[model samples]
Target: MKPLNIFYAEPDADRWFKYDRYPRRLIRRIFRGPQRPGGVMMVAINLMKGLDRLNIPYRFNDYRYINKHPEELACIIGKPQVLFNREWKNPVLFGAGVFSHPIDHAKLFEQYPNLVKILVAGEWMRDMFEPYYGDKVQAWPVGIDTLHWAPQAIEKTHDFLIYDKTRWINEGLPQPFIEPLLQTLNKRGLSYRIIRYGSYNSDELKQKLHTSKAAIFLCEHETQGLAYQQMLATNTPVLAWDKGGYWLDPEYYPHRVQYSPVSSTSYWDARCGLKFSGHDDFEATLDTFMQNLHNYTPRDFILDDLTLEKCALKYVDIVKSISE
Candidate 1:
């Protein structure tokens, strides 16, 4: 039972303002509740939970322990700033949402050229980074907690749960894709519930999934769509907007970088459900998807590839692979 060194930090405390400090922060927490953690934070949280399930020994954010054992592998799952200030002696397994793009952090990559592995969520993301980082880049998605996301014994009150995470802003305009979809759903006399990405919490979404027959995921792309995966883990089929083409991040698209064949659902299979490109194909796809909805066994896919213990073991293997 060897121990593993893991480091993670986000919403870095040093960057907190006066209002975000001590008494004020405490008051805010009391009145407003603690702020919900974003995707990157969840990645670290889920990994630790997975490790715990396997009874794996691991030290979290224990920098002193890391300093003492420089020859050990240090898995840094987090904000790049944690690694920026100092040169690490340990072989590192850097995972999860560390960098948005390689162009933005060329110097960071250069500084830590010996990083055992630079992990992204999917193969498409790996392709985007491979040109710059070469063989050092690998795709490694975190596991989902199947027990938490399991199907509930509830009556399905709605036909679809519309999960809108379309991030591209149209400059003071409503989302282009959603309105039309809503209209079509109305015309078809379908019962559905709409939940915007940042507006709703996980519990609310979980309830919606339990009540809905299926989910409609409207996102441009996902490095690894945790929410959508959760929906699948709950045995809910998804009608995803998988407009596969060049990466469309405004920061690095046509002019800067043109990585192709990007997907809205990074980890998907036939068992998960259907995919439609946009308004054009959506109606037809929806009809077909609904017609064959009963056949989908999305939870099976999760059990096979992404159970908590399974992914934790994979992470252990990844860490062990790093050279001392």
Candidate 2:
């Protein structure tokens, strides 16, 4: 019997440490990690996602340094195989861990006879990849690093805790949410601090979230919302727009994650999350959220299964299927 092999072909990137919590023991091969962030996929953050539970004991092989040719990428294989994306070819059996680009999996199979399948993150992303790979692409949201984002025992306040990007004010909605939210909050004579972790320390972000009453994220669109999940884990009430914005923020469609109605006033319960459409009607939604903020003690949830650890296991299973 022979041990199964898998390659962990990390890019030449930096901040790989940010994902240090992600398990790196599942591979039998490696190409050294990258030297900087945003290497391949607009930032290819995926390189280090779900690092919290990375512990599958396996051998790790070294990279074959070539003069200048691009690093040879070995996909979803357990055996040590070497080939260029152009020369050595095999039908792509599946795109289990593949992200969506402007291409489809079938065409991917056609263009590169070696590509047989592709599993994307979600329906939105699938649309991007389906055109290039065809029926080969599917959506399967990846997991996050939970251990670093779990709940803790801490004292909290009963006030409005709005968690958002710093741009909320400088980049307030030209004529909508932001501008109105500012006016709305001011009129009520309420004082709340907006926490933006653009480049802040993790400890600091955690501290603010714990003390605050709720976490609010109102953005355009998101594919997968990592921060939202973390807030949920902490039991902090969440407020955001519907349909999620930009993949950079983990998006939750169909109300999977909780987001307070950006236009509601009944925000006292911090159960799952509240949500509102980013539509013109967001004003009312914001009003509702503001009202809810007036009289609510944030509550937490028992999100044990949704942890990043569990998410990683599911991803590993997809990888294993592709390998098999």
Q: For each candidate, what is the lDDT?
A: 0.86, 0.46
lDDT string, candidate 2, 243-316, tens digits: 33333323332233333222221112345556765546556765676566545323333244454455555655
Candidate 2's C-alpha runs over 4 A off are 1-55, 58-100, 103-107, 165-177, 243-271, 279-305
lDDT of 1 at 291: 93
TM-score of 1: 0.93
What are the per-residue Cα lDDT tens digits for candidate 1 across 140-220? Answer: 889999999999999999999999998873436666768889999999999999999889888999999999999999998
Q: Tell me the lDDT of model 2 at 76.
A: 40
Instruction: In model 2, state the lDDT of residue 90.
Output: 31
User: Model 1's lDDT to the true fold?
Assistant: 0.86
